[model samples]
Target: MRPTRAGTIQDAVARCYRAAGGVEAVAEQLGLANSTVSYGTEINEARPGGIGVNHLARLAMTDPDCALPLAEFFAALAGGVYQPVGGVAEVISLFSGCGLMAKECGEAQAATILAATTQRPKDIAEAEREIEEAIAALTKSRAVLTSLQSGAA
Candidate 1:
């Protein structure tokens, strides 16, 4: 099973600190105190209370290379999966990925009908409509992301 969002965030904090050398080094880079960074990187079930939102924002804003990873880290914390691409968060890309999956599911249903099961056309049509709804959801999600990116959401 996958780790919870809190666990993922903790892991990311530790990984980020390691990437920057150590807690001290990361603190120096992030313009924060060593104790703060140390507390944030500690493994725990809840979020690192020591690392405030402002601190996290500053880390992403100041460190270009760490920006998207930090965004993904935050997204995971919010129960969303936003992968990084070229140091940028590919939020819109998630919609595209879901669209592809829905398309494939529709196609799979058709293939399955041809191959074995004696499922009724209504069943196949219902599955296809469900996939269509998923595609529609992707479209709506993409629109919302676009609006957010354009500072209109």
Candidate 2:
């Protein structure tokens, strides 16, 4: 996955947290920016609390097997490949395990979860839509490729 620019201060803080290894690490690495990292971490910790109407709708559109790659993809984004945050390695580790199923629990659901935990919404609905669309297109393309290969054989 390609890296995305850190769109919000929260995104920047998350990047810092990942780079520094949790909130404390981020603070020390950034030279006394601990409070910022701590604040960001606290906000992010509240996103998983509730279910929303949009979340349920998105959930209805998802498949079960697509979560791991999605998480890894998002982790990659958070790791600052494009944006170059301070402590990306740590961020990658933290986000790498978010399975697709967990990640795909619908945009609103995911947002709600994130909001519940972190008190901030990551605005992942657009990304989720694109991913789902991409997955479908890829699956179709793969099926076509397989068919062509078998036919040629």
Candidate 3:
């Protein structure tokens, strides 16, 4: 199965730390103990939990973009994806994007039908790529609709 764009928590946390200018800078920025940030950014096979929500919030307050991947990391666990919606402009874009999303769905459906009974490896691979593209479009549309539903944009 394809991994989510959010990647693993280790990946997300490390990205945040990197964006905040590495462990020491992040620790200083967030007023955290050096050990805490060090532990938080530790790359490991174990699940991530060294960072607290409050610290994350503080970090996010200063560098919002840095936290987005981490938000996506958790959202994907709940079978959802996170997209930043910048109120009116994004809302306008979402509506416009819907038309393109519909086109993608049609393309996906055609590809799936074409590959349905095919035994050829290449054909199947092409269909898989098409379907993934369509899925991404649909997921974006869904997120847009969800934001509207929640009055977020």
Candidate 4:
């Protein structure tokens, strides 16, 4: 009942902020001003200049949950559902489980696209890694769900 960021991009930003351990940490990590980080994370609509697309990407890369809400919103807009991975690792993806799965999937997709467009070996290799990670995440998520369904979790 609580995939909190799934509802809005602003919520996702705030989630990312929390995932990063708050404004000061993210600000220090991203070399962004504290005020900018604060503004980006605030859920209030009155604030302007919420994180830019590039900054969002940079920030999202720092943590997994940061990207889940944004990904889910986009998936919904595209008439698809975003499936999250299980939260198993320290310093892992979205909401821990599902967010991680979606983030991995999205990163893999992006890598594949870059490989296709550039046809570079480095890009291809990165794509392969991304794909493998995504598959693992999805597999884990599936297993968890199966266990839950069978009342084994």
Candidate 5:
């Protein structure tokens, strides 16, 4: 059967959580602001019983991929037609790479590269040069990551 939005969101979140070692890591991988992911987790934790559609709707607005059908589900609950939110797959795909790298390269190495890419250096030219060097280094790391992915490590 084809995957649904809700299923996809759930899967993506779960995979990210597992790969990143936690929701914070997942949030970082997703490029989401830490406060946002923390708030969402807090809400979910507070409502251990369950949160209503309305609450979920609010969450979807803040973090669209938080749940499935996401926009539609929220809309339907808000007395509107179900309108799907597109591009969630792309978001998931992008974040999934971090998880893949984490799994393949080990968290320490993955974190090193992630930090390097996300940081803003004092000198733009220097940063660019550093990034180029990092990319070149990836030629070696990629071989290792690839082997790890293939279970050859």
Candidate 6:
């Protein structure tokens, strides 16, 4: 899904709020004032106010499930891709698989190039396997990203 930068951070914060069972609950869990936890953010706004780094940290520490989504939303606001921390093993696995598949795809492409240059028979089978692996990796990556975006994983 193409996630809009608008309100993404606020939206993530809202998800955290819900996950923690609302602003007061979050405040209690994080040991912060209700106003502080709810400050500078509009859960329903298309674009809401930004949360400070300290507050974000507190939320993440209090609710690990919300960490990745929050960071990703903040990254979108910053005009960059969010890199997941090592907090979630599953996300790390997905990212690692993507990297390996990317490497394999590159190797297959290089083989195809070499065959073309040397007038050798192209390894169609190998090429197909590489394509499949790449597709699978992409699919997995997309799933992980969607999960992270939705704050469900």
**Winner by lDDT:** 4
lDDT of each: 0.61, 0.40, 0.71, 0.73, 0.45, 0.65
lDDT for each residue of candidate 3 in 1-153, tens digit (9 for 90 to 100):
112234666667777777787888888898888887777655544635467667877887899877886788888999987755444443257757788778887887787777887757887888888877777676666667887799975
Q: For model 2, how does the per-residue alpha-carbon lDDT over 10-96 read when each residue is reduced to its tens digit?
A: 444344335334556534544545454355433343542122224222322452222223333356767822212222222222233
Compared with the true structure, model 2 gives a TM-score of 0.21
Select the stronger candidate by lDDT from 4 and 5.
Answer: 4
**Residues 110-141, candidate 4, lDDT per residue (tens digit)?**
99999999999999999999998988777676
Clashes of each: 0, 21, 0, 9, 1, 0
TM-score of each: 0.45, 0.21, 0.62, 0.45, 0.21, 0.45
Q: Write the per-residue lDDT of candidate 6 for residues 1-153, one digit (tens) a residue.
A: 112345556667767677667778877877778876776354435435445667767877977776867777777778975643333444466658678668877876876666556664456555656666555556566766777789967
What is residue 41's positional error in candidate 5, in angstroms?
A: 3.3
Candidate 4 Cα misplacement greater than 4 A, ranges:
1-6, 42-49, 85-153
Looking at model 2, residue 34 earns an lDDT score of: 48
**Best-matching candidate per TM-score:** 3
Q: Would you give me the overall lDDT of model 2?
A: 0.40
C-alpha lDDT of residue 100 in model 4: 78
Residue 65 of model 5 has an lDDT of 51
Q: Candidate 4: give the clashing pairs.
A: 65-94, 84-98, 85-97, 85-98, 85-101, 86-97, 87-97, 94-99, 94-100
RMSD of 5: 17.8
Candidate 3: C-alpha RMSD to true structure equals 5.7
Give the range of the ten consecutive residues with the poorest summed lDDT in model 1.
83-92
> Which residue segments of model 1 deviate by more than 4 Å?
1-8, 43-47, 85-153
Show where candidate 6 strays beyond 4 Å. 1-8, 43-51, 83-153
CA error at residue 71 for candidate 2, angstroms: 21
Mind giving the per-residue lDDT tens digits that candidate 5 earns over 26-143?
4565566655544433324444313234544454455545544444434655787543323323223334545544454453454456567776454444545554444434334555
